[model samples]
Target: MREELLISRRGFMLAGGAALAAAARAGGGPAAGGVPNVVLCMTDDQGWGDVSYNGLKAIRTPALDAMAAAGLRFNRFYAGAPLCSPTRGSVLTGRHPNRYGCFMPGSPIRAQEMTIAQALRRAGYRTGHFGKWHLNGVSGPGKPIAADDPLSPGKMGFDEWLSVSNYFDTDWTFSRKGELEKHVGDGSDVIVAEALKFIAAAVREGRPFLAVIWFGSPHSPHKPLPEDQKAAGGSAYYGELVAVDRAMGRLRSELRALGVADNTLVWFNSDNGATPAGSNGPLRGHKATLWEGGIRVPGIIEWPAGIRKPATTDVPACTSDIYPTVLELAKVTVPNQITPLDGLSLVPLIEGRMERRAAPIAFWHNPARAGGQLNTATGHAALCDNRYKLHRLPDGNWQLYDLVEDISEKRDLAAEKPEIVQQMKTELLRWIDSVAASYRGEDYRRAGIPFAPATRPAGPATAPAARPRRQQRQQARRRRQ
Candidate 1:
């Protein structure tokens, strides 16, 4: 009799309001077991201590500070790679960028790999992508990518997008669903405004949505609005960040005004560490290095309906976890058995049930070879467990640090604990071997998959001078074009 009554109630709901029916079909609304909307906001080169909440004294980020106070913040969060494109790929696939040939910036993500957007779209979610889209290999500064570009967000399952192939500044042109559109304002504000339009429409239709907003501020050639530049006390770099902070504030307040703030999951972080203009706290090294300063980034997630209490955790997490966590929340599964994923879902941690990470995080940065090309002798690699982290430099020298005791990685403990060093070395090598196998195309069912060799464009190089001639040429050509 109870089962019959429950069935009758469900039938009544299905036959009631059109909004309720749409919500039920979209896995939203109270009767359908409320599916939360998702918003992922990532900055270009902001670092671990770039925000005021993390003790940054140079600039103020009241919006982000407020988010840290009202949400779950991550003290030891990391980017998937030390660079932009690779880390973005990991965020979409929950796999290392090398697994799919996105080794560094300007490298395009392979179309064969399944993406989070694709999975969510199958689950009845409206997907939109905004702001920087460096995953496509249109390498100059920023430009509107061709509509038919294989790596565009449309091909990655995003239903709508207003994006640039790379970073943008003030008064930049954006590709709106593959068509060029001009916007006048701060770049960060422009993207957030477009994303809000999509979100508002989804809410009006009672549909769950996934909005990915990638900011192109605080990056090289920093160009902040005049007002923001003045607000930053005349520092162009800090001025760019001021624009980003203001945009973030607008995004949060607009969501609340739309009445979806409580049910929306807004996750914010940086793609990697800082540039020369930013700070990575006390850690050593910066972008392009496999050190704590390169990968460690500020991370926060606000989901009032799910995470009832605001909190912070030091448990290690990375951008790669985004894909799996979203899948877990949407209750979706991949249609095919893909390669082994390096990221684990963070749902357990979000629910306060997890005390430790299930697996250690691994990072490899080798720009000399293409993604998935195994050249252990040519690049830097690091493996970090809960306490100990081992770094293998290009010269084959190994350095070990206990992160808990040395958050800044100032002290090397390799000589003091040889046993732990050997143990970690063995584990790290084993993992590297697996990654090498995947790099050899062993993970793909078909062979001869083409990889676009890194190209050099004709222009003054913005990257390090040590970069190979091929990459320099690629950058030069991109500039000339």
Candidate 2:
């Protein structure tokens, strides 16, 4: 039997319904789940400790805090990658970004890979992606691509999209299914309000919906809207965070008002760890490093009808888990031909049936080496077996940490735990071989392939500076040629 429920806008009153109603009225949107909806909300560069509930003193995140209280808080949750596009790629494909050729930020995920949106669409769900869609272009410092690129959210699978080419802020221009729509307001609010419209319409149509709400905030060039700043007491960054909190509160209230809060599964997290502008509490390292602070993110899963006790679980989890979990929840099946997924469903964990993952997890981040619009480099690899984590850097310097004992990864026990490190190293290498093998056709042979070379420190110049006479001669030679 198809389950159905009606959310009385009146119930929102108990949870500050007036404020929610006012917000809803001012924004003018549809109701919540007349159909099943999935809201996957991500904050760019937001730290794990940015929420007041996470020990952040300067910011207020009542809505996110409330969600944590009423939902499942994953203490060991991690982003799929330590950077934006890579992690976002993981969310879309349910596989490591490297597997699909998304090595770094601007790397494009092969359109062939079956995405979360594509999967949900196959299940008769109206799919939409609102906010940041960083998966389409090269990200590091460089030139921008033509706005006419075909592989955007519209090309990815979302039936509707309002997104920026990159992390945009303040009065930004978003492509609405290819046409541009200029929004004026806090970036966070603008994105959420746009998403609620899709949610409302899907509800009235009695159709299932998947709304991937990826926010562009707290990333860089920190600029908060006036109201958000006022709410956060003049701290521009705090204001950005406050805007997200209000957005969350509005989303939750809408879900309840539409009467689908119980059935809907709302997942909240960050693309990676916090940036330097953000605080990660006890975790060490910042956004780009391999440390916990760089990858470990604040993750919450809420399904009122599904999850029992407002609970907490320390089982290590990753964003890769999102695809599989949502697929299982929606009872959608992937074709046998679509390469097997890297993630396992976390339904068992969410339902309190399991305390730990049944299998070990692996991670990697290989810096890009391709040149021209693509000259980039940032490589990393990691593997986890139970509580032990092994990190393989491109520099050939490997480290191991017992996450159970060293959440911050402050101590490197690789030297002391040689036997375990060797075992993990073997596993990590074997997995890398497997992933690399998949990338290269089986029986494909190559020689002198260098992987994980030792990194040299920058001290004295290795080569003398180019002489002006030599440079002039080179230019003259080029002209003659």
Q: What's the lDDT of the predicted structure labeled candidate 2? A: 0.72
The models' CA-based lDDT, in order, is 0.80, 0.72
Q: lDDT score, residue 72, model 2?
A: 96
Question: Which ranges in model 1 have alpha carbons more than 4 Å from their true place?
Answer: 1-33, 367-372, 446-481
Deviation in Å, model 2, residue 81 alpha carbon: 0.9
Residue 479 shift from truth in candidate 1, angstroms? 14
lDDT of 1 by residue, 355-401 (tens): 89989998878635545366655678888888989988888899999
Best by lDDT: 1
Per-model TM against the reference: 0.87, 0.81
In every candidate, how many clashes are there? 11, 9
Query: 297-332 in candidate 2: lDDT tens per residue?
Result: 899988887775899888888888899888887878
